[model samples]
Target: MSAVPESNWSAGRPDTGLTPEERAAEQHLELLDRVIGLEQQVAELQSTGLLGPSETIAVERNLAAMRSSMTWRAGRLVTLPIRAAKVVKRRILG
Candidate 1:
């Protein structure tokens, strides 16, 4: 029988020999999963019909203002399509 080689285990890494591309893909999937979960939570919050407390409302208004700004809009316009494509690919694969 042929001898099987072993990788070094001195460090604290726990990976099971995933290649770089495979590891990157795994991390990407994890990020996509987090986005999906957060979207679900936001949907649930919206469905509650509670506008939240006054401070929360104020914070949300400030957030909306920030989102509406030209800089933010421009950044979103550039980055969101890439993120959307990744999300779409993940959905299609699943």
Candidate 2:
């Protein structure tokens, strides 16, 4: 049989040669752009003063709940792979 080439093995993961810091900076810039957009929205809402005190309170509560939910979901997402690995290892060994 013919030998498989090393280039063929790595073909599935082509390298763009970007450093980790460069990738992180790119992601940071994208997140900053989203933050700027959210800031603009908050400013617009403040200038309009469309929400009364009770409505504002309700909105703030909802925003806090959403933030908490997002944080929880993010933590779960980060741990999911480790959890799956543990389950697989337990099934294999136990």
Candidate 3:
């Protein structure tokens, strides 16, 4: 029998020559790792609790990340003013 093409796999899994059950287990492990990573990232962001410019910097970093993404970039126009204000504030405060 012909091996399944890469795209036909569920979850867009690559053809790693593993059996279906093994692939399922591997995907589960991968998903678990991603969840752990996301949790760690959230913890990191939350731990940066600060006030004033430092807090604004943190928010700007998050916004920058969102702006870099294809899907979220749709909202970039809405946030342009906030970014402009930050630029002006930074110049004035510095």
- Residue-pair clashes per candidate, as listed? 0, 0, 0
| Model number with the top lDDT | 1
Instruction: Please give the lDDT score for candidate 2.
Output: 0.76
Steric clash pairs (candidate 1):
none
Model 2 vs. true fold: TM: 0.37
- TM-scores of all predicted structures: 0.40, 0.37, 0.38
Give the per-residue lDDT of model 3 (tens digit) for 36-82: 88898899888986568888999999989877998777676778899
* Model 3 steric clash pairs: none
Q: How should the candidates be ordered by TM-score, best one leading?
A: 1, 3, 2
Runs of candidate 3 with Cα error greater than 4 angstroms are 1-16, 53-94
lDDT score at residue 76, model 3, on the 0-100 scale: 69
Candidate models: Cα lDDT each: 0.77, 0.76, 0.75
Per-residue lDDT for 46 in model 1? 87
Residue 38 in candidate 1, Cα distance off native in Å: 26
Give the lDDT of residue 10 in candidate 2: 29
After superposing candidate 1 on the true structure, give the runs of residues whose Cα lies further than 4 Å from its correct spot: 1-52
84 in model 1: Cα distance from truth in Å?
Answer: 2.6
Q: Which ten residues in a row have the lowest lDDT in candidate 3?
A: 1-10
